[model samples]
Target chain A: MDIIVPIKQVPETSNVKMDPETGTMIRDGVGTVVNPLDLYAIETALRLKEAHGGIVTALTMGPSPAVKALREAIAMGCDEAVFISDRSFGGADSWATSYTIAQAIKQAGRYDLIICGERATDGDTGQVGPGIAAWLDLPLATYVASVTTLPGADAPVGLSVERLVEEGYQILELPLPALLTVVKEIGSPRLPTLRGKKRAKVTEIPLFNAQNLELDPAFIGLKGSPTKVVKVATPKVMRSGTVVRAHDEAEIALAVDRLLAFLDERGLLPRGDRP
Target chain B: MSFVWTLAEQHGGRLKDVSFELLSRGRALADKLDTKLASVVIGDGVSPEQLEALIRRGADEVYAIMDPRLAHFVCETYSNILSHLVKTYQPTIILAAATSMGRTVMPHVAVRVHTGLTADCTELDIEPGTGNLLQTRPAIGGNIMATIKTPQHRPQMATVRPKSSRPLPEDATRVGKVIEVPLIESLIDERVRVTGYRTDTADFVNLEEADVVIAGGRGMKKAEHFGMLHDIAGVFGGVVGASRDAIDRGWLGYSHQIGLSGKTISPRLILTAGISGSIQFLAGIKTSETIVSINTDPDAGLHKVADFGIVGDLFEVLPELQRRLHEHAAAPPAATTATADDERPDERQREERV
Candidate 1:
């Protein structure tokens, strides 16, 4: 099996906070890291390669700084890396991003499976994986929690996986050359080894641009994206109620009493307690 | 003629609540645009009453596509049917609840029809002059809200978060049309097959339907501390919920999680302890009727949004609250008035010792 895992570099969302006074994002000191979730996808690919014997390739689409993400993936044990970067790909939505990545995947030759993180932290859409599957006309599964079965020399040429749904879990079977978007339940990601880090530092990562991929100018970037962000603003703060400083035991009792009174006023206390 | 369409979602032969919620919102949009509001449902055993219910909940028309193959959700087959309908009818806007099924299928349909799709929109509106569907959603982990538009795409699509809005009350006297559309054979794709489904017994608490939710977060420190939350919930006949932080730490199952990536809940009253309230967690509980937060940090974000904020150690506060609640539940009906006074001296003594 030849596996390809698509990864992204994203700002540490936990560190991205809103400036209380200005109501603007405080991105000054926040640094970019390989989207934490994508680490699971890379680990899944590496584990599959170790078990079934295949080459695991890390693929990414972003500005040149994204090469750092690919190197990190290599350090986590990916066999090779493919980087797709260009000025034209800026401002792309999920649709256009998936289109360009699909084109890149096509140019990277053959692959039996593609894996992606369930969603990116910044976009939080979980659309790109399915969008890419649509662009490539490949069977796709999202929120896969576990890979129950994989095709091997003795097994059939299909894959079975467990998908995490709202109600429960669904066991699904799909043919080879399918795409899966994985959740955290898949497995805990592993740290990089010294040898793997050494290999990653010197590995040559080939780059694919729109010109080389022969992507149509009309379907590559901002011009090609159908959805446009017309306006962005800080979410309105809805509540500015009382904040009690309960430093002493007396204050704690008073705070608890206030909560009970509030609940009582709303008739939200337990039925027996409602007067 | 162009119309506003809502893809009604169903499971086990019943329409989901979000389906009606979409129609409730779509009804307003359709009226603003001076167009019809239609609902499309694809399932195996949809009854006539279910179709009529859609109409009573504000759908001008309900399109039913019944097939045994659609008894289970397959994105390829469902998107093919929807893409075909979009191409044939050319609706002006399409709305779906951002549930697992909606999120899975809408993207494929949008791609097939060459349109734009906004996911998990908290607000939807019709632009005043141009009549575009305005999609407002949280981005960058809910640090910012962005309003999006699809100027060139027909059947402009967006998925609204479930529980963000309430469904309009059903009007039994109202009447509308029900059109049963035949499922085309070619639309069915057999590439992926769902073999089985297993309910997670560990997540038996129906957090979404709980009238009262008591949640804990990282400040709880360890999984064992969640027991206090559970005890408090038991006193109120409620369920225990957890923030993403607690869930990520394996302190609670995902089903009890309240956040952007987990379940959105709108309980009548929610009491959270130790939770700093990340925006993602706020998104899930913003629709809650009332919020009370207890945290050690005075500046925790949750305090900004909570109706009642207590700056105290959850470790001490939770145990005290739990004991008080149990006492309240056990107190005689006549003694309820004196319960506060009865506990005041004991609480003060305990605090002074600390």
Candidate 2:
């Protein structure tokens, strides 16, 4: 089984904060990291390769800086990493991004499975994985929690996986050459070893651009995106918050009492203590 | 006439509340455009009353397609049917609730039909002069809001957050046309099979249905501290929830997670502790009636949206609040402001148990 895992580099938003005085965002200290979700995808691919006896290839499409994500993937056990970078693919949306990636994957030769993060942290759209499946005409499964290869190991017929649904969990059996978008529940991603890090630092990341993939000019960038952002603005802050502060035990007790009284006024506190 | 279509969602033989909410919103949009509002119901054993209920809840027309294949949601089959409907009807707009089913099927249909779709939209509007559907959603992790438009797509599509709008009152006397689509097995691809489903029995919080939610975030520091959150939730007869960060940290299960990638909940009241409040998480609780936050950071983003906030350590604040609530629960009913008719069964159970 040859598995291809798509990853991306995204701005770290966990510690992103706004400037108090200017009200503008302070992005100086916030650096780019491999999208947190994609780590799970890479780990899933590596696990599949380890069990099924095939090579895991990590793929990504972005500016040249995205090679760092590929290196991280290599350090995490990807046999090889492919980077698709070009000026033409700069401003692509989910649709065009998936198309570009699908084209690149096609140029990378044969693969049995493709794995992707459920959604990117920065875009949070979650359309790319499904879009890639559609563009490639491959069977797609989203929110797959666990995947097990069926009985036919040599030429795997299909996969049995547990899918997370809204109500509960559903077990699904899908045929081969399918795409899966995974969540954090898949598995714990492993840290890179010293030897792996050393090998990854010198590993050549094969770079493929739009020209090399021979992607259609119209379908490679912002021009290919159907949706356009008409406006962007700061969200209006609606609630005017009143902060209750407490320093010591006495103040803490008093604060809890006041909060209970507030709940009482709102009918949220339990009414008429029973038994 | 131009039509605004809402894809009605059903599970366990009952229509989801979001389906009705979407129809209500679609009706308003259709009225604004001087068009018709149509609803499509896809399921097995859909009764006539269920189809009529759609008309009662503001659908001008109901398209019911029944088949055993669609009894359970198969993404490929449903997306194929929806794409076919969109192509044949050529509706001006299509709306679906941003639940797991909608999020899965709508994108497939959009791609099949070669159109664009906006996911988890919080606001929808019709642009004047051009008469295009304007989809507004929090972008870049809620730091900014972006309004998107699919100018070239025929059926502009969006997946809206559930409980974001009020459903129209049901009118028993109202009547509308019901068109039944004949199901063909050849059109359905039966690759995936549903083996079985199992709900989490022990950790079943039912966050979406909970009246009150007590959520913890990354600041809780460890998985064991979630017990503090659970204890506080127990006091209020509420359920426990967590942010995506906490879930990622393995502090809580995915079922309790509330965020863009998790479940969207609109509880009557939500109390969040130790959470810094990312926009992605805020998106899930946008429709919550009352929000309260307890965090050590006074300048946390959660404070901006919270109706009330406390600046302190969650570990300290949680125990203090839990103690006070326990004391109150132990106290007799001295001065009851609640009427006998107003007492909720869950509160009574909590009182009896505590």
Candidate 3:
């Protein structure tokens, strides 16, 4: 099996905060890391290769700094890395992003499976995976948790997978050349080894630009993106209420009384009789 | 005339609550655009009453595409059917819940029709002059809100977060049309097959549906410390939730996680212990009505957003709160003029009565 795993470099979302005075994002010290869930996708691919024997290629579409993400994937045991970056690809939405990536995949070569993280923390849309599958016209599964190969006459022809749904898990069978977006339940990611890190340090990652991939200008970036962000504003922080601090047991008792009274005033306390 | 359409999602022949919510919102958009509000239902043996219920809830028309093969939600088939509908009917706008099925199918359909789609929108409206669909959604882990537009795309598409809005009240006297479209054989793609489904037995409570939620964070320290949250949740007949830190630390299941990557919840009351609210975590619980925080640090970010803050050790405060709750529960019934439960009406029931 030849596996293709798409990954993203995202800002540490938890650290993303707003400057109350200016009402703008505080991006000065915010650092980028491989989207945490993508690590799981890379691990899943590596494990599959270890079990079934295949080459895992890490693919990404971003600015030049995204090579760091690809190298990190290499350190995590991806056999090869493909980077697609160009100024034209900037401001692409999920539709254009998936289109660019799918084109890169086509230009890269053949693959039996494509794995992606369930969703990127920054976008939090979980739309790119399905969008890529749609662009490639490949069978796709989302929120996949587990996978097992189905044996054919001579080699494996398909995969039986468990997909997470609103209710629970749905067992599905998908043929080769299918794409899957995986959730955290897939497995914990393994750390990079010394040998893998050394290989990653020297590995050559080829870049695919719009010119090489023959991407149409009408459908590559913001020009190609159908949806546009017209306006952006910092979300308002609505709470600035009373704060009570308690130290000794007496203060603790007083604090508890105040909390109970607050709840009681709002009629939020549990049903009970009061003295 | 072009309609404002909502794809009604169903499971086991019953419509999901979000489907009705979409219809209600779509009704307003339809009215603003001077168009009809139509709901598309694709499932096997979906009852006439359910189809009519869609109309009663605000759908001017319900397009029922019933077939045995359509019972289970397959992305290929559902999107194919929807793409076909969009091509034929040319709806001005299409709405769906930001659910697994909706998330899967909408993008596929949008791509097929060559249009733009905004995912997980919190607000949707028609632009004043150009009549474009204005879709507003949280971005960058919910620290910023972005208003998006698909000015050139026909059938402007967006998926809304479930529970963000309530379903419109049912009007029994209202009447509408049910148009059943035959399923075309070419639309069915059999590359993927559903074999079986297994319910998740591990989830003790539905976080999204809970009236009250008690969540913990890294300050809870250990996996065992979550017991305090569970005890407090039990007292209020609510559920336990956790921040990403707690979930990543293996102290709680993913289902209990409340954050950007987890479930977005809007419970009536939510209490967080030791949670120094991250932007991502705040995204999920910001819509909650009453937020109470307990943290040893007075300046925790969570305290900044909490309706009430207690700067104390959760270990000491939670046990005390739990004991007080127990005492409250065990108190003599005669002394109370009216119990809280008796006075507080069921929120869902109130919505229905609206």
Best by TM-score: 3
| Candidate 1 residue lDDT tens string, A99-149 | 899999999999989999988877778888889888888888887878855
Q: Give one digit per residue, the lDDT tens place, for model 3 in B217-258.
A: 999999998888888888787889999999988887776889
- Model 3 lDDT per residue over A79-161, tens place: 99999999889878888998899889988998989999988887778889999999899998888889899987866789999
**How high a TM-score does candidate 3 get?**
0.90
The top-ranked prediction according to DockQ is 3
Per model, the share of native interface contacts recovered reads 0.65, 0.62, 0.73
| Standalone chain B TM-score for every prediction | 0.83, 0.82, 0.86
> What DockQ was computed for model 1?
0.53
Error of 3 at A205 (Å): 1.6
CAPRI rating of model 3: medium
lDDT of 2 by residue, B294-316 (tens): 98888888888988888887778
**Residue-pair clashes per candidate:** 0, 0, 0
Among these predictions, the greatest lDDT belongs to 3
lDDT of 2 at A252: 77
Q: How close is candidate 1 to the true structure, as a TM-score?
A: 0.89
